[model samples]
Target: MTNRAGRTGTLNEELLRKAATLQEALPYLRRFAGEVFVIKYGGHAMGDDTLAKAFAENIVLLKQVGIHPVIVHGGGPQIGRMLERLKIHSQFVDGLRVTDRETVDIVEMVLSGSINKQIVSAIQLAGGMAIGLSGKDGALIQARKLTRSKADPDSNIERILDLGFVGEPRHINPDIFNAIDLDAVIPVIAPIGVGKNGETFNINADSAAGAIASALGAAKLIMLTDVAGVLDKDGQLLPVLTPRDVLVLRGEGVITGGMIPKIETCLDAVRNGVGAATILDGRVENVILLETFTEHGVGTMIRRDDPADGEGG
Candidate 1:
């Protein structure tokens, strides 16, 4: 009986390995198959060497499969470290860096010029061709200074404080993006936008990526964060959610805190014509493939409220 059980276990292990191989190949077979995916890379995944290496490998595979993957990255941890080293006191106005002229200079150098190139180099070292870019290159993203604060919805108290040199994405030029022959080349984007004055301002990587996806008519937008996607009140992964479903959750108080804005962004992208918006945990190995290939995708997939979209599929 013991020998029989061992043989069965070996056969099961072989079958499982074959199944995983097939699952990984599905996304590759689909390839660029007329899909554009935007990925926002940040958080602890950026700090861990192993995770970063895994991220690079996954990106290379996406390119190999003919998928037009665009990368937008945040260097918050790097910026924080640099600031600390320079003894510059960091201040935030509603979660935005209060950038003065000096800070803006540092932000541009670290984000667009320095760290951007480093990421490109890493991808190349991983045998993936990559190009580093920013919003200013070829007028990719036009912007204007943002004045943000809590505003009264009742049209009573208008609180608009200058949020330094933060720029809101007014337009996205995907021409430079389309012009590239991205056979195995990836475009690493830094969240820096050009203003009417031709000045570069720090932009939020998440909002910038969402805007780019909408402009490019991307099939999907993926935001890689520390959280394990949207969870139910019981702390279980919700798996699938629609824009309306998110609204109901907000009302029922199932979603609150920092998750509110994140979910709101996901819903907005889904509503604005992107096929889907996914909030995934980058810490997972091969998460990109798991979400795109498997029947049960990883993370929370925020889809349109229109039932017709998935009922038949």
Candidate 2:
């Protein structure tokens, strides 16, 4: 009889803790109601079946609670795997894939055809209406070729490298989002754009999500990465940062390699009027919920300025 009583007590404690968590989330749910959250979902999280299902359920929960979510997903690993299977050689310049004409076709196939629909199907199976789209659909993102200059180590001279079919967003047309019923549908976007000459260009998913968030004036732009947000020199998460803080970190070299571009995307999105931008570890189960609904978020959040104007956590 004592063992049975103890088991019931433990179960009651767990139930109370769960209820407490929901109560804590109520304020955030009310605060962000009717706001838009643009999520850049990628990394290993998308490949894991359990994580993918949790992500879909989170999106559905957000919608059911009256917050709209727009997803921009990356497929670098998937694209590389496909290219390898096809025996196509590829290279990267400054971390941007140097996509040739043929390579761009494969990128499009993987991103728009397989990956996009996969996410949509996951969300639909989780009991949400999800529509998959590419930047070429409805002229969503107008892009221009991205050009990079590399410094020659010997002569200290900069030389331009042409990354064929690799493009950056020049403009974002958000009218396509209006056609969807935000109350019932989520949009899963593939980062393939159309150039001025009607050529298909492969866009970086982070950049595309930032541009879309800015154009939509979203309340938040959340980037799901593999790492635990931006780390300090001591390797601790910074939690909150301003654009100036990001620039200082970059200058100090604390932020390097691929992280620089991700930070730049967050800075750009916040400065361009997205309320705030976050970089969080997508590996955590229900990471989006923990970041959005809790008092202490799980990653670095970059804001345009100080949170003195009744915004930001």
Candidate 3:
């Protein structure tokens, strides 16, 4: 009887603590209320059930608190799996997947339709109304073919090689986004765009999300990735960084390879009017809540201007 009572008392204490935390979050919530927030949802969260639920709950709570959350997800792994099953040999030029016509169709099928719907369904199951959409829907993201050079010099790979339907977003139609009744429904976006020629293309989710956020003048752009954030020379995460800091880190060889494009997306988002771009670790539990509603955020944040250390979370 005594042990049962103790357990009950502990539960009560935890409840009270949660209540206090929620109350404290009210001011932060008010500040972001009615503001658009674009989140690039990928990394481990896209696969893990627990992380997916946590992500869904975070977006739901953001809605409950009056912040409009727009989600753009990347299912590269899924797309790769689908491609493999089709026995299509995929070739990568540079870091980007060389998406030909057939590959583009596969990308659309797996990402825009299937994975996007799954995310929406999951969000809905978590008690949030979610609407799954694609860049082709109402032509939200208008893009053009992106050409790049290959690496095989003997084949004259330096010459501009067309990657077929692969594209980078050139414009965003915010009207499609605004039309969604975000008071209850969350927007789940898949990164696939259509060109003026009525051709469908595969777009990088980071690029799409940044473009969308810039169009919306989103108060925050949160990119959920595998790593914690940009690291310094000592291999420590840079909690805060500016565009100059990014260049500095790059010069020091701390930021290289894949991190470059992601950071570039952040920089572009900020430059294009999004307030801030935060690169967060999707593996961590409740990271979104900690970043948005609490004082100390858990990952790297790229802003136009760095906040004073120990200030302005």
List RMSD in Å for every model shown: 3.6, 1.4, 2.4
52 in model 2: Cα distance from truth in Å?
A: 1.0
- Looking at model 2, residue 32 earns an lDDT score of 93
Clashing pairs in 2: none
Instruction: Give the per-residue lDDT of model 1 (tens digit) for 1-313.
Output: 4699889999999999998878766754564455678898888788788888888888877777677788999988898788888888889866778888788888888888777887788788888899999889988989889877777789868788777888888899878976887555689999999998898788988888888888877778889999899898899999889877888899999889777877877777776787788889988877887787666778988888786542110
The alpha-carbon root-mean-square deviation between model 3 and the true structure, to one decimal in Å, is: 2.4
Model 3 steric clash pairs? none
Task: Rank the candidate models, highest lDDT first.
Answer: 2, 3, 1
Better of 1 and 2 by TM-score: 2
User: Which parts of model 3 are misplaced by more than 4 Å?
Assistant: 3-16, 150-157, 306-311
In order of TM-score, best first, we have 2, 3, 1
RMSD of 1: 3.6
Best by TM-score: 2
* Leading candidate by lDDT: 2
Per-residue lDDT of candidate 2, residues 1-313 (tens digit): 4799889999999999999999988999998999999999999899999999999999999998999999999999999999999999999887889999999999999999999999999999999999999999999999999999999999989999999999999999978988878777899999999998899999999999999999999999999999999999899999988878887888998999889899989888887888999999999999999999988878898887666622543
Assess each prediction's global lDDT (C-alpha) against the native.
0.82, 0.92, 0.88
What tens-digit string does per-residue lDDT give for candidate 3 at 117-174?
8899888888899999999999999999987865675775556777778899989988
Name model 1 segments beyond 4 Å from true.
Answer: 1-12, 23-28, 151-156, 308-313
